[model samples]
Target: MRLFAVLLLALLPSLGQAAFRCGTGLVDEGDWPVEVEERCGEPDYVAVYPEASLPGIGIVQTVEHWYYNPGPSSFIRRLVFRNGRLQSEDSLGYGFLPGAAGDCNPRVLNEGMSEFEVVRRCGEPLSKRVTWVASDAYSRYSERRSGLQGVYPVEEWMYEFGSNQFRRIVTFRDGRITDVESAGKPQ
Candidate 1:
């Protein structure tokens, strides 16, 4: 039973492909190479990332993350995908600790919440109204703040939106968060 369970656990990753979404430019394993302009909004890092071979399949991907607290950690969840499958989801600690995720949940942004409001809670939106032309998808992103100097740096917070409410949130640095997509109330 234990051996079977372990095997199932290993195979589970290949299954449930729905949990994974391929990025634009670099289509899953086969299509054209994905462009950085399409993924990371407006190129603003110490150095721009270059295109590389897909990690698993033939897809292309870019990795960005946040850096922050206990474990003195990094929220910058790293990942890259070139094909219809996932290249990686190398995030630390499942997007935030249990209690922390709960604390971060504040209602999803609606008519009242301004850009500044979003920043107040989660820091800066990594990509504002980030849109992908090929599939007609979009995401609004943000990152958690970093700690004081000499501490862990690179804290990140992400909020992805499709038209409006997205289903994914990621912290690149050391930031943590609870699901906010559900204010759970009616719009």
Candidate 2:
């Protein structure tokens, strides 16, 4: 019985794929946006990516990430939707109280952090710029046969700490931070 229970516990993650509770309700992959909204209520933040076009599929899917911060006692949840269906879910570090400013320490910022994580820790930026870059998909049979996978959005967010501090610019690609740089104070 003990071995059986342990095996079951080990397999549970594979069995469930991924899911999270919303009050008394549960949201899982493949759930519709409306159902998630109904179960989880409004999200704290939402990021929408431009439509991705496959080689033969035309413009078949649009991607969005909805972030929910259920206060300081719980972990933040990020629900990813593609074409109106929940494709996956992620749990961020921790939730923060609504309307409270996040820690804006520039030293704490680093690469590979998700957009939600940045927002959770640093709050909103002073200004933002967005652009789309083309990503390539290679053929399985031949590496030479490359095609346009899709255009992914890249965003640069600027944060100003104080007059004595240099402004920091954080760049994100595919929802993850790729670079952080400093610029002179605004004139």
Candidate 3:
């Protein structure tokens, strides 16, 4: 019995490995976007960004994040695709029902959460501004080594709760939240 228990523990992590199921089909990393779409159907939301450009090769690598919300009972799943192939999968917080407004509470916002998470919790922002900033020294060095220039996208999403509440500004860098600030109450 003890030996069996140990073996089961060893297999636990493997059982939780990243994979998404759709009806009878399962999608895994390295699969094509078409394969994932065929199995999982269209995603609830999709965000695409250019990751890097290699001038020498005349190649631009784009990254796409496809979000699936399988209702409130299941965790939301994000499928990441790089250069048209599935690269990784992530499980996020519980999903809400379709067509329902997100349960937005500014206090819950924090750094390091993905832009997808913010959208999932707050629905759409009233206004969004996008900018491109030069990559950090480390990222620039790495990209330069590969004959690529590093410029990353930065976005600011502003949300207004109500007349009685303060407006919030959320800043995202490289697809992740970097800062959140509370603006004065709406005029």
TM-score of each: 0.19, 0.76, 0.74
lDDT of each: 0.32, 0.77, 0.78
- Residue 138 miss distance in model 1 (angstroms): 34
TM-score of 2: 0.76
Show the lowest summed lDDT stretch of 10 residues, model 1: 135-144
Q: Candidate 2: where is the Cα deviation over 4 Å?
A: 1-7, 51-61, 135-148
Put down candidate 3 lDDT per residue, 1-187, tens digits, no spaces.
9999999999878865756576579898889999999999999889887666444553366778898889889988888898888878888778878878656888868898777778877888889886655657645763664455755456789999899999999997656788999988988
Mind giving the per-residue lDDT tens digits that candidate 1 earns over 1-187? 9999999999977664424332332323222223333443331111112122222443133333212122224332333332222343333432333224321233444332322224434545544222122211111111111111111222223554434454334322212232233322223
Error of 2 at 116 (Å): 3.2
What would you estimate as the lDDT of candidate 3? 0.78
Per-residue error (Å), model 1, residue 168: 34
Better of 1 and 3 by lDDT: 3
lDDT top scorer: 3
User: Which residue runs of candidate 3 sit more than 4 Å off their true CA positions?
Assistant: 1-20, 53-59, 135-148, 184-187
User: For each candidate, how many residue pairs have backbone atoms clashing (under 3 Å)?
Assistant: 44, 0, 0
